[model samples]
Target chain A: MAERALEIRSESHTYPIYIAAGLRHQTADILKGLGKSTFSAVLIVTDETVGPLYAEEVAASFADEQPLYICTLAAGEQSKSMETYYELMTFALNCHLDRNSVIVALGGGVVGDAAGFAAATYMRGIDYVQMPTTLLAHDSSVGGKTGINHPLGKNLIGAFHPPAAVIYDTETLYTLPEKEWRSGLAEVIKHGWIQDPELLKVIKDQWLDLSAVPVDVLNDTIRQSIQVKAEIVQLDEREAGIRAFLNFGHTLGHAIEAEAGYGTLTHGEAVAIGMDFAMKLSGKVLGSSLDSEAYNEEMIRLGYDLTIPASCEPETLLAHMKRDKKAAEQKVRFVLLQEAGVPLVRPVEDDTILDLLKEEMTI
Target chain B: MAERALEIRSESHTYPIYIAAGLRHQTADILKGLGKSTFSAVLIVTDETVGPLYAEEVAASFADEQPLYICTLAAGEQSKSMETYYELMTFALNCHLDRNSVIVALGGGVVGDAAGFAAATYMRGIDYVQMPTTLLAHDSSVGGKTGINHPLGKNLIGAFHPPAAVIYDTETLYTLPEKEWRSGLAEVIKHGWIQDPELLKVIKDQWLDLSAVPVDVLNDTIRQSIQVKAEIVQLDEREAGIRAFLNFGHTLGHAIEAEAGYGTLTHGEAVAIGMDFAMKLSGKVLGSSLDSEAYNEEMIRLGYDLTIPASCEPETLLAHMKRDKKAAEQKVRFVLLQEAGVPLVRPVEDDTILDLLKEEMTI
Candidate 1:
């Protein structure tokens, strides 16, 4: 299959995202093309799960001139913590990595966030490339938002350090677990609901079993989702304006993830549920004309659990959402859809969210 | 003395610097004028020495609407490390400081670098105000260079995160220790050597006794130093080009400080020695006519120890210099002065640096 290349243009940096079946083996050639000779060392940050499987292959692609070091973290959301971040820094320092050193983040979003942040602060910022092994990383790889989670919340500490490049090898998806595929598909569905109704229609009509989707359709969908994210991020690199639209389901999604104690559910799983709540809230508040029943049918067919867990209390969830980074002036602000593709960020009262949560819990 | 305000215009942000004798007491008004109402909380990151003396007064300046919290680290260069940085992040999280929160860095360069770095990475970056209580902070507060020291080296990890505003209360300098006064003067003299020879002459002629300099003269000298720093930082916020000149003596200065152990010798003291070596090296290698005798005399009169300690080996110092962030491809780069106000960054051969260190040790 021909490689599909897309560019993300931001104020501080402009990088390319290459989507292909077997691009990880071409890491050296691609990096060399992006001025790799200046680098003296390469530190590959991956998770325990992904490291044993692919880190060596990626490391082999590098020329022997630049020595390679690998640092692996536990494969889960827990690794995206300040402890892990500091440990990565110490490992990089111990390896004698200098300013000219490059960090290759070769895993899913967790590894990307932790490693990218380490690169951002290591030596006051260094270059890093993203070799995403999971479908979820496609969205994260395009944006320069890299961070570690705080005990109080998710992604509470981070920096906007864009990757030097993103090499997305779709071939890795063949080995991805079924649950991981379901988790990643939620974000792809989110991209469609937030900004691309046409893409949403394509998914609804052609793809129901995410694991069985054809290669061409999967690549096309991922590229379209990334383009939507890239365009939004390009317009507002710092999330000062329209970029908040990308958080359509994240306000509640993050609250659920935090309340559920991260790892209890995947990021996409929580977001899928959040999207359901958002659609219901939009219909009641914004009088949005979204077809709720049809959307629910599609989600159910695609194997998404849209129900709020019994253990997650509505009050506690509401409290968690208030602490979200997107909150303003002590109010819970959410990104609600006006229709399928028309999204709006507005400050919603606590009582309204509480009522919606209570109502959604029963469903 | 009337409050003097200067604007630092950088491509990423434009913020004001407030310098006066007791501006710390007016923190609230100053912050309000700069749009403080938007903030939900304020985190004051100070040091043990400064916190006990002034944290309360600074905290009282804020309105009750925005809750205040204080986190203090030991008052020394040793506090500027990854360990301290992690502790501060944990404190901020415990206080529930959110995205709209602001961090007030209230101490010397150590607190500024550590606290500024925390703010830079917290929630992917937040606004931080520099309430510099030490003379050395005047140089550090304006440049937006924030980072923690690594065990391997001094300031080996950091970022270019400019503060929202700088509140330099000169009154705080009155209580500063004599050694600190001498330590900070090195940077002031460095400002003169790199960009303002007239200011250098002024310091030599009018302020031979740093402790005895009149308040008016001291304030004028600080503003002049800051102006030189501000102009260079404005042109290069990221240290990509001419901004490197700011590291006039930092390469060797950092090496000496690291070799001597963090708190054994102050930053400015080491830099003073570095300046002495750089001037001699300039005369020998660059064929620049720098008045080494006059420069050494001024340094001595200003109470700067211009000698390398016997315990710090030349080889170790040379090795540390090679690991400096400014070094490229194993070459040690120095900001050599062709003449006063005409600085150049050139790659110096390792052998040349080794010989200079050996010769300077005997001096």
Candidate 2:
């Protein structure tokens, strides 16, 4: 397969993202080409599930170079916590990894976030590379937003430490479970909805059964999604402006994930539902002319439950949204679509949100 | 006393350093003048000792505009640990501090480093102001280096998050204990040794008893020391080149501090001994023509112990030095001075270091 490369340019740093199948073996050569020869050691941070499968292969690539240490955490959102981050730092210290060392994050978003945060802070910032094994990481891996979750919220503590490179090997996705595919596809769907409506049309026209999608189609979709994300991030690395559009569905998405308890639902599952709610709210509040019926049918066909759980109270979710990092002066800020490919971030009133939640519950 | 301001320009950021005797009352105005009107809340991170003494006054400055919360840690080097850092993050979360919130580090280096690190990681970086309460902070408060210490070494986990402004009120130093004065003077002397010999000569000529030094002289000396540090940091924000010069005495100094245990001996005291050892080593190894006898007499006059403590073993200190973040490939790197203003950073072999330890033990 031919390799495709994209450059993400930000004010502080610019790095490339290489997408291809079966490129894991090129990790060391690619890193050396990027001017990383002075590192004394490499710490590979992965999850237990991914560790036993691919870590050795990646480590083998660096066999002749500096010593490589693998630090594995349990696989899931629960692993993205302060406790896990602290343990990873301690592991790096025990390995005697210095400022000259490099950290290789070798799993999905959980491992990437935890490890990237550890690298971001270990010795006051070091270099890290992202070798994302999951399709969802196609979005998370590019931007420099590395962090661990607080009990009160998701990604409340983090840093903008961009990865040295993102080496995405689609071959690894062959082993992904069907449910994981549905979860990852939600983000791809989100990328299409926010910036590239044509991509959404293509996804709808092709790949009706995500579980059995063609490899070429998957590769093209993932690449397109990353390009949208990279363009937004490059323009606003700190999220001071246009980057807020990327959170079109994440405000309520994160709340649902937090209220549902982390890992109870995959990130995509929550985001899918959040997107449904946001579309309805935008229609009522902003008079957005989105084709809600068509969007809902597509989401249901893609294996999503668009209903808010019975256990989750409207008031509780509203409180969570207001506490979101985007909130200002106790007002719940939201990214509402004026139309497809045109998102607007503004503060929504509590009474209006309550009304929307009541309406969502009836559905 | 008149106010003095200096601008530190780096590739990543530009901030001001305001030095005066009574600027504490103007904290809020200074921040507003710097265009910080959007903050939803202000978090004051201080130590227990300084919290009781000055936190209320500082808190009162921000009373009308935004909500204020104070999180205080114990006053010492031991507080610069992961446990404290985690607690600060949790506190910020509980207070609902978001991306727009500002963190005011209202104490010396310990509070500044710990709080600055928290702000750096909280929401992937936020704005923070430095309010230096100790003269020793003249060095730490200027640089963008912020972090917590690991059990393995000091500042092993951190980031280079620069402050938005540094408000130094010399009035705070008047209440400092005599021991704290001696502790802060070591860094002042170090600044003189590394870049400004004229400053060193002035210190030696004017101040015999550090405890009784005139307030005007104290303020002038601190301003001069900060200028030296600011000039160097402006040239190298990430510690890539000229920044290593600032670590002239820190390699061995940090090892001694680690071996002695944090807070057992003051930081300046450790640096003083480290400076003495580096000078002697430079004379023997680099063939430098430094007058060691005259320097030692000056240090003794300033109430510093020029000899390595009998309790600290040479092999142990060497082991600690090898673990420093600056160490590469098990060889300890030291910042040695060929003369008063010419510094060199290079690796010293294990055998040579052991032999130097033996020589120093005999003294």
**TM-score, prediction 2:** 0.93
Error at B201, model 1, angstroms: 1.6
Cα error, residue A46 of model 1, in Å, equals 1.3
Model 2 ranges off by over 4 Å: A1-4, A259-264, A310-316, A325-331, B1-4, B260-264, B313-316, B323-331, B349-363
- Full-model lDDT for every candidate: 0.85, 0.85
| Tens digits of per-residue lDDT for model 2, B14-34 | 888898877888888788888
For model 2, state the Cα shift of residue A279 in Å.
2.5
Which ten residues in a row are the worst by lDDT in model 1 chain B?
B322-331
Checking candidate 1 for backbone clashes, the offending pairs are A124-B158
